[model samples]
Target: MRAVTWALALWLALLGGAAHGAGRGSAAEAQAMVGKAVLYLQQHGRQKALEEFNRPQGQFRDRDLYLAVFDLQGNGLAHLNPRLVGKATGDIRDADGKAIFQAQRALALEKGRGWVDYKWPNPQSGKVEQKSTWLEKSGDLIIMCGIYQ
Candidate 1:
């Protein structure tokens, strides 16, 4: 009985830790990541920066928060989804039927940097959840990083 209790406690602690680490990123972190990626892009050029941004475990990727870049025309230059890259993605809608990329593009065009909220399926929870991305316009590129709420 004593050993069983100890094992249960350990399992619960590990589960909590996993949940905490999974969504550790915040809105501020997303903004900062976009800024960092812009700097990296200017320093490294497009091809190299795209490779780094697309890297699953690269510097631009922090847990679920990862960098994605799209052109002003809504063509994905670097995205988590390889299929979206080099294609028009502005028409993609959220579960709620919101034109997410169009909204994001408006923010980039008008404000140059801001947050856009949408809903996405959380793979871990297997349910839809709120997500917000901080995006910045870097010349023709719209760089972004999102935090799961």
Candidate 2:
């Protein structure tokens, strides 16, 4: 019985570590998405970049990691969420009453690129969860991609 318990605990420990590693991998992949998107925006210009970002079946849409672009004024220029596109998000708040878009925009503008953490609805799970988004300033737009944690 003691050996069985020890084995089970070891298995659980390894499982937990694997999960943590997977989470880091997802974040890294999301970061890469943002970097690739910045390059795409820089090379193609806003119109084409927005079109590609909004494309449902395009390279930008990778599972839950999708590209979003918001103008410095906090207006959605390109988003996977159809309801958000062309909407003013300057005052949009998360579940914690944090002005999520404003914070992201400010960080992108202030630092030129960084990550912002906020509560967001995870589409796959349909639940509000902790999310971290990587932001990059592409001219007048703040490009982003997030990972749910």
Could you give candidate 1's per-residue lDDT for residues 1-149 as a string of tens digits? 13643353345345543433555665556667898999999999988999999887789877667888999888988877688888999899999998989999998999998778788765456788877777899889999987676
Name the runs in model 1 displaced over 4 angstroms. 1-22, 123-126
Error of 1 at 122 (Å): 3.2
For candidate 1, the per-residue lDDT at 99 reads: 94
Clashes of each: 0, 0
TM-score of every candidate relative to the true structure: 0.81, 0.83
Candidate with best TM-score:
2
Candidate 2 TM-score, true structure as reference: 0.83
